[model samples]
Target: MTTSALSAPPLHSSAHDDNVPNGEDQAQRAAELAALHRAADAGEEAAAWVRQLAGRQGEEEHGRLLERVAEAIVKASSREIIPGSDGLLTEELRYTLAADVVLGASHTTGTLPELHPGERMPLIAVCSIAATLPSCVLGDLVREVEVLAAEMEAATDAGRAAELPAAG
Candidate 1:
């Protein structure tokens, strides 16, 4: 997708004049634009990689999840950096999310008991793939996965309790 599609709106509206001089304001705006462009480029490249990986693995659902995670990371990071910025570019978000999903799946799969030899190979591959992502993105993914795992564990425990015989 085009960079424009992935890019967030300008951080500051020109309509509201700031205290800074005209030239200075223009320069600041230019810098912000440049940063946005860089972010968009990075996001697009990540997204393309995710798509290729998903296609190779024949895991459309995992791909979609990873893309969403990537998008969330970009959006959150962009907002943190640019006060008035709308968020990550659409394309960037898509790619980021795809990668995040794959990472999360790999993490979950790795934690399970291996039913067959080499079952953990995908997890190893995913870790290598995750190494390519920014630390901030990985941090966010870990937090998300932790929350999900906790919820799943709670549900499983509840199910097990339900299966127990009634107390005498």
Candidate 2:
């Protein structure tokens, strides 16, 4: 691809008037997406990796959890698209939500127990995957965060509480 297709010069990045996707960034984003997909879907192998990453488990269940979380995240992300407004992009993108969930929430408060020979290691590669990318994919990422926030909540008022249902 031509250089022009890759970037609009650094000066233009602040100007969102153009709706075109950056070729270079797109390529990078694609690769990042693939890596996240792999990291999440590696299943038990991922679990063991998470344990080591979290300092919770050993090397045995890494692949397993990796696969589960990655696969789940992908499924969750790919399921929806935030209806664009006036045909312009915004923070409703999954990438944004993902980055917040994995990097912000999981990294902050997800360390837990039972990584012996077989256990869940507070795996959040999918979240990390989302967290690492740009904020363009937030709609997909939001679902994950919402789910996690729901799970981590204690009693009725702790953690990120779920939104109340809309009134008719």
Candidate 3:
């Protein structure tokens, strides 16, 4: 009788069909995830392009656009996330501000206009979160944003190169 430790049966049998190749499902899933990531990345680029165009128009216009976008995000998540339970600006509201409120003069405006109930919560939340960010973290965040911008730029260049006709 031959003794071999390598002959041990697998601890669990695969639920998939026997003829189906291994890693095919995982490869498909990976491709799907990559597609989703690419779509999201393209969306971010589109938003930044819009922001840049707005900024080119004027500071006031850009600021207003930022405020509107932030407002939309906050309003969308109001009932489920913000709830207005702890006054108007809750922690959740602050987090939304962090992600959505990049451009604007709302931070400079110290006094907030009186808002009825849920109104202006987004603006208030934005200014509050902007004011709360530590200087060091803000610096780091700016650096990271720059890095991401460079990466996106490189990716765009690579894609354009791929699309161009080969020289004779």
Candidate 2 per-residue lDDT over residues 65-159, each given as its tens digit: 43444443443333321223232223343343243322323343454333332222133333443333222244443344334333322211211
Query: Taking the tens digit of each residue's C-alpha lDDT, what string does model 1 give over 1-168?
Result: 455733655556675656434767677566555544454444344434333444444344555554554445444333333433342244554444342343445554543221123322332333223222333233343343334333323433443344356789
Q: Report how far off residue 152 is in candidate 3 (Å).
A: 14
Question: What's the CA RMSD of model 1 in angstroms?
Answer: 15.7
Error of 1 at 120 (Å): 13
- Candidate 2 regions exceeding 4 Å error are 1-17, 44-168
- For candidate 3, the per-residue lDDT at 50 reads 31
Q: Which regions in candidate 3 have their CA more than 4 angstroms from the true location?
A: 1-11, 15-22, 59-63, 66-168
Sorting all predicted structures by lDDT, with the top scorer first, yields 1, 3, 2
Q: Which 10 consecutive positions of candidate 3 have the poorest summed lDDT? A: 76-85
Model 1 scores what on Cα lDDT? 0.40
Q: Which candidate gets the maximum lDDT versus the true structure?
A: 1
What's the candidate order when arranged by decreasing TM-score?
Answer: 1, 3, 2
Against the true structure, candidate 1 reaches a TM-score of 0.38
Which of 2 and 3 is the better model by lDDT? Answer: 3
